[model samples]
Each structure stands twice: as structure tokens, then as C-alpha cells.
Target: MRHHVILRVIAKLGIPFIVLFALYVQFHGDFGPGGGFQAGVIFGAAFILYALIFGLDNALKVAPMNLVITFIAVGLLVFAGVGVARQVSRLRRARRQFRRRTASRHPARRARSRDHGRRGHDRDLLHLRGPGPVAVEFLIGHYNYWIFIFLMMLGFYVVVARGNLVKKIIGLNIFQASVFLLYISIGKVLGGTAPIIIDGGGPVTYSNPLPHVLILTAIVVGVATTALGLSLVIRINEAYGTIEEDEINDMDQEP
Candidate 1:
């Protein structure tokens, strides 16, 4: 009974704070270095804590698998949609700029073959390099945050929605792996190579290696957590002869 009381206290107090901290990490990531992955883990840890204290059913009621899946999907879609919008806007602006430049030229000057060819070539190149597209690419960098967000959501959905415990672990692994993409994306610089100190630092231009190193450590932690979570699932299945969350709840319901 004392142990039960302790669990209730943790559920009431600890869980709320964990969730609040996760949001802080998520939003504050842009200013510092952390972002979605760190936030996801913190958020996941809160649910995990709740599950430990009050059982999975109650935790699911607070954050249903469907809702979690939706959040993950929406986050990714928003990121990608922004990129596409920027590309379109850039193309329109470039076209307008090109037309304005051409219209201002004298007829005689425009007729000169060499000048015309050069101008046309330059205009074509500018059109090809649309400002919106470039700006979007520049804003997001190369790692593709949208893809990462999608994978993260996919993983989380699988973990929450699946009845099989092992499948859930697999989903968690995918979710965590997605963060690596975000880190890699942000750390990339144009014309930069790996940060390895080989041959007296040839060309001196290289991407930051810190995010990669940090992600590697995060992956290790993710793996450990997955293993532990899976083990617990297996034990739960063995004890109750069911892995479906609803069934487990029914079994645990008071007589």
C-alpha cells in the first residue's frame, strides 16, 4: 500500500513537470542546439514514467497513440510544406525581376547578339536559381527536417499503436534514428567536408562534428531504453498472457 502511494505521488507531480520541460527543450532548441529529438525523448520519458506508475492504460488515456501519431505527422508536414512554399515564391519573384531588367533595356542594346546572349544566359541562370527555392533550402539546410519529423512520428505511432511488444521497440528505434537526420541537416555547410584531421587539414572547410558526436551518444541511450522497454513488455506478456493494452487493462480491472 505504501509503494502504491509512492507511485501515485510520482504520477501526480513528476509527470507534469517532465512534460513542461520537454516543451521548453523543443522550443528553446533553435536558440541553442537541441530540438525535436531531445524534446521527443523528454516527452516520451514522461509517458514512460506515467506508464510505470499508473499502468499503460492510464498513460494511453492521457496521450492516445492516435493523437501522438497525428502530432508527429503534422510536425513533419509543416516543415516540408514550408520548403515547398518558399520554392514557389522564389520562382515568381525571380521571373518578375528578370522581366523588369529586360524591359528597361534600349531596343538597340537588346539587339546586340553578344550582349543579348550573355544577358539571356544570366537571366536563365537566375531563373534556375530561384530565390524562394534557395531561401527555403538555406533555411532548412540539407538534412531535411521534414523527413526526420515524418520518421519520428512514424516510429512513435508504431510503438504506441502496435500490440506486439517487440514491434513497439522497433518503432522506438526508428523514431530515435530520425533525430540523427535533423542534427546532420543543421550541421552541414556548403563546400564543407568531414572534420577529420587528415593530411594537415586539406582545404580547411568542414562541417561541425559536434552534432554528429552528440547524436551518436543519443543513439546509444535510445538503444538501451528500447532494450529495457522490450524486456519489460516481454515480462508483462508472460505474466498476463496478453500484450494488447486494452486486454491487459481489463485483466487488471478491479473485481
Candidate 2:
């Protein structure tokens, strides 16, 4: 790689742009078609590209193992924190509303509340909300789901059937990609635009932003997984002198 001066220069020129675009995709995800996963992949690819051009040693110098691990933990904690915060807030609001409603109720209702208690009222409220029917047309709209299924199966088969470590990693990536596609497809609303509100008279439809946001986090996790897998594969090759699963197995079995 060091011998290829032109390639190194081009990589140096291009890596910054790739990283910048990844940041844009990460930030613009709510208003556009990208999110964490896509951005993470792009960012990971930039580092991977840098590693290829400049060498893994230098790449590690930039993104040390401790730094990577810390960021991975931070990203996961942030995602989990958002979910926990939302849940806690919702519960508090629901409790406040319930107290207000119960307080405002008539004598008979108050008597029932005293008898049934807070738990009973909450249980009744949950039971009151029946399951909704699924529309056939709604299911039909997800033509991309079949693609997701197909890719998932292909990736699964590769992981299960292949002996090559690299091929298995590729299959794992494909499997992750299929799941990503499935989530994206599930979040899509036909004719829906970005989930942004405009100060216009026209009623606008916005796609669900949750899926994109979730996928971004998933993407970050995926990048971490990929890096970890590659590192393990490197270690395995160095130790066993082969990356094929069967070869490693045979070597392990030998005296």
C-alpha cells in the first residue's frame, strides 16, 4: 500500500469527504433518506478505506481500541437512555392524567376507584383498547419485504453453509442489511414525505421518524460488530494459519 503513492494521495483526498458525507447523512436523516446505520457504515468505510491505504496501525492510532469501545458504549447508552426517558415521561404523564380523571369523577366512580384501586383502573383501561384489524392492502404495499426475506435467507445460508471466515462475515453483513431493509420498509408510508412540518396551508404527510433514528443506532452497532469480527478473524488467521472453519476445526482436533 505504501508503494502506491497515487492511491494513497487519492485516499487521503477522498477519506475526509466520505467522513463529511457520513456526518451529513447522520444529521440530515430526519429530513432525508439516511440515518445512523447508513452514516455509520459510511463512516466505518472511511476508516476501513484509511486502513487500506495508510495501514491498520495508523488507523488504530486514529481510532484506538479504548476510544472505539467507549464510543460504542456511549452510543448504546444514549439510545437506551432515550428509550428509558421516553417511557418514564409517558408513565408520569399517564399517571397524572389518571389522577386528574379519577379526582374529577362522580361519587359512584370514586367509590368504584376506592374499591377497584389504581391497578384495576389501569388494567381496565388496557383491556378497553382492543386490537385493531390489519388491512390486506396495507400488507400488499410492502413489496420490498420479499426482497428483505430473500436477502435474509441468502445471508443465513451463507453463514450456515460456508467454511470461509470472510464469507461468513459477508453473510453476517448481508443478514444485518436485510434486517435494516425490513425496518426501513416497515417504516415507510406511501406518499409520505420527510417528517418535517411546514408553515403552509396544505396538509402534509410525514413518514415515521422512529425507524430512521433506530436504524442509525443499529448502524453504529453494526459498524462495531464488523470491526470486532474483522479483528477476531485476523487473530484466528494468525493463530490457526487458516480462516476456514473446517480447517480450523481439523487443526484443533489434531494432536
Candidate 3:
């Protein structure tokens, strides 16, 4: 790798852009597509590329193990902090609304609040009725769900049937992708645009952003899982001279 000057130079040039893209994803996630997990993976990947090109020792020098661990802890804290902040904000809003309603001396305001609550409950009940009768529109609209099911089953079959460790990891990734697709499909609403409202925009349906956010976390987890699995496979290969599950089992049975 030291002799590969062009490769090293290209990596050096590309790594910064990769990192910048990751930042863009992290910051723009709230308004569009991207999130913290995706950003973290991309950031980590830049380091990984650097390691592959410059050697592990150099990579360690650039990002020490202690520093990596610290960053991971900080990330966890940030995620937890955001959740805590949101929960606290929600509680405060609820408390303020309750107080506002209680402080109102007008009977009409209290009646209106009660009526609104009843209407909300009724809406929930109506939702409980579930999907309407199946039709061509429903089937065509749910094509993404069908893709999810197919990928899920294919991945499941591969995981169960394949004897190679690498194949198993690939299957897991496929399964993870299926889950991502499912979440994205669930988030999308027909005729809904991105969840953004312009000042002068008329009433518009917005796709749910929560599922996309959650998927970003899942994507990070999937990346970590894949990396860990591959690392383990490498270790297993070094120990047993093969990555086939059956061969490994046979070797273990021999002694």
C-alpha cells in the first residue's frame, strides 16, 4: 500500500468529500433524507479507507482506540439527550395546555376541549376499522411492500440454507435492507411530499419522517453488524483455514 502512490493519493482526496457528505447527511436529515447513524457510518468508513491505504498503525495514530471509544460514548449520550429533551418538551407542552384549559373561566372553552378530545377518540376508533377492501389501487400502491416481502424471504432462505459464513452475512444484509425498505414504505404517504412546509404553501400532506429517522439508526446498526461479522469470519478463516460452517463443524468434531 505504501508503494501504491496513486491509490493513496486518491484515497486522501476522496476521504474528505466522503466525510463532508456524511456531515451533510447528519445535518440535513431532519429536513430531508439522512441522519446521525448514516453520518457516523460514513465518517467511520473514511477512517477505514485511510487505514486500508496507509496501514493500521497509521490509522490508529490518526484515530486512537481511546478516541474512538470516547466518540462512541459521546454519540450515545447525544442520542439519549435528544430523546430526553423531546420528552421533557412534550411534558412541558402538555402541562402548559392543561393549565391553560383549567385557567379558562369560559364554559364554552371547556366544552370545546371536551368535544375535541371526543373527536380524537372517535378518529382513533375509525382508524381501528383497518384497510378498506382490496382493490387494484391498493395492490399497485403496495408494490414496495411486495418487494420487501420478497427480499425478506430470500434473505431468510439464504441464511438458513447457505453453508458459507460470508453468504450468511450477505443474507443478513439483505434482510436488513428489506427492513429498511419496509420502514421507508411505511413512512411514505401517497401524494405526500417531504415533510416541509413553505410559508405560502397551501394544505399539503407530508410523509412521516419518524420511520426514516429510525431507519437511519437501523442502517448504522446493520453496518456495524456486517463489519463485526466479517471480522469474525476473517478470524475464523485464520483459525480453521476455511469459512464454511460445515467444514468448521467437522474440524471441531475431529478433536
Candidate 4:
């Protein structure tokens, strides 16, 4: 790999753009489809390509194993910490709601609550001007949902039924992708635009951005998890001389 001068030069030129693109994805997520996971994979791939061209030792020198491991741990911790904070915030909100005076509850209060519930439901599905039963039923029975279900089940089946470690990892990725689609689907609003506030925008329905933000974190976490799983598989293969589950089991039973 190191002997290929043209390859090395091309990698040198391409790696920077790849990393820049990853950064673009990371920041552009707020405004569009790009996000953390896509960025992380792209960033990782740049270095991987560098390693393939320049040599593993050079890549390791640039990003030591210790640094990589630490970064992974830090990322996981930050993700978990955010989740814990969200849970705490929710609990506080619940307590506040519960503490409201029962005697003061009135029709207006009920109406407000009902409106909030309606908005919540709308966030999960497009709020048609007047969604009749047929429209509701049709949306619920859409082919998008069937595709999501099929991918989820197929991924689960592959993970459960496949013998190859690599196949299992691929299955897990498919399952993750299905979940991503589900969140994106539910977060979409038919007539909604971005949640950006602007002057003279009049009245606007904005799609919820929370799901997208959460998915960004989930995507990064999923990438880390996949990398760790693959590393473990590599180690397992090195130890067992094979990555097939049945072969490993047979080897274990040989003793």
C-alpha cells in the first residue's frame, strides 16, 4: 500500500474533502438531512482510507488507540448524560403538572390540555386540514409502514438466524436503519416547513426538530456500537480462526 505513490497522493487530496464533508454533515443536520452518524462514518472512513494508503502505523500515529478509545467512551458518556438529563426534566414537568390544584381544574384547562394532546398527535402524523376516517385509515395503512416493518423484521431475522458474525452486524445495521426511518416518518408534517422563525412568516406549521436531534445522537451511538462490534468480531476471528457462530460453538465443544 505504501509503495503506491499515485494512490497515496490521491488519498492525500481526497481525505481532507472527506473530512470536510463529514463536518458539513454534522453542522448541516440542524437545517437538513445530514447528521452526526453520517459525519462520524465519513470521518472514520477518511482515516481508514489514509491507513490503507499511508500504512497502519502512520494512521495509528495520527490517532492512537488510546485516544480513539477515550473518545469513544466520552461520546457514550455524553449521550447517556443527555438522556439522563432529559428524563430528569420530564420528571420535573410531571411533578409540576401533578401539583396543580385539582379544585381549579375547569373546562378551559381541559380544553388547553386537549389541544396539547392534539398537537402531540399531530407531531406523530401529518395534521391534515380535516383528516377524515378514510384519510386517517389510509395513512395508518400506508406502504411506508409496511416497508419499515419488513426491514425491521428482516434485520431481526438475520441477526437471529445468520451464522456469520459479519452478517449479524449487517442485520443490526438494517434494524437501526428501520428505526431511523420510523422516527423520520413520524416526525414529518405534510405541510410543515423548517421550524425557523422569520419575520412576516404569518402562520406556519413547523415539523418537530426534536426527533431529528435525537436521531443524530442515536446515529453516532449506533456507529460507535457497530465499530466496537466489528472490533470484537475481529478479535474473535483472530482467536477462533473463524467468525461463524456454529464453528465457534463446535470449537468450544471440542474441549
Could you say which candidate leads in lDDT? 3
Misplaced by over 4 Å in model 1 are: 1-143, 199-203
For model 4, residues 61-174, the per-residue Cα lDDT tens digits are 999999999998999899899999877778766767765853244323433343466655434443444568967676665657667889999999999999999999999999
Candidate 3 lDDT score at position 244: 94
TM-score of candidate 2 on Cα atoms, chains taken together: 0.61
Error of 1 at 250 (Å): 1.2
TM-score between candidate 1 and the true structure? 0.44
lDDT of 2 by residue, 1-255 (tens): 978999999999999999999999999988774587679889989999999988989999999999999998999899899999877778767878887876754333433444344254333311333334433433444457768888999999999999999899989999998989877775565677765545564655545566666787787688679879999999999999999999999998998
lDDT of 1 by residue, 130-222 (tens): 577775764455337668878999999998998777788889899989988877765565577755444554345566666676787888688
Model 1 residue 79 CA deviation (Å) reads: 40
Clashing residue pairs in all predictions, respectively, total 2, 3, 0, 0
Clashes of 3: 0
TM-score of 3: 0.70
Q: Give Cα-based local distance difference scores for all models.
A: 0.74, 0.77, 0.80, 0.79
Between candidates 1 and 2, the TM-score winner: 2
- Model 2 residue runs over 4 Å out of place are 15-47, 60-142
Winning candidate number (TM-score)? 3
Whole-structure CA lDDT of model 2: 0.77
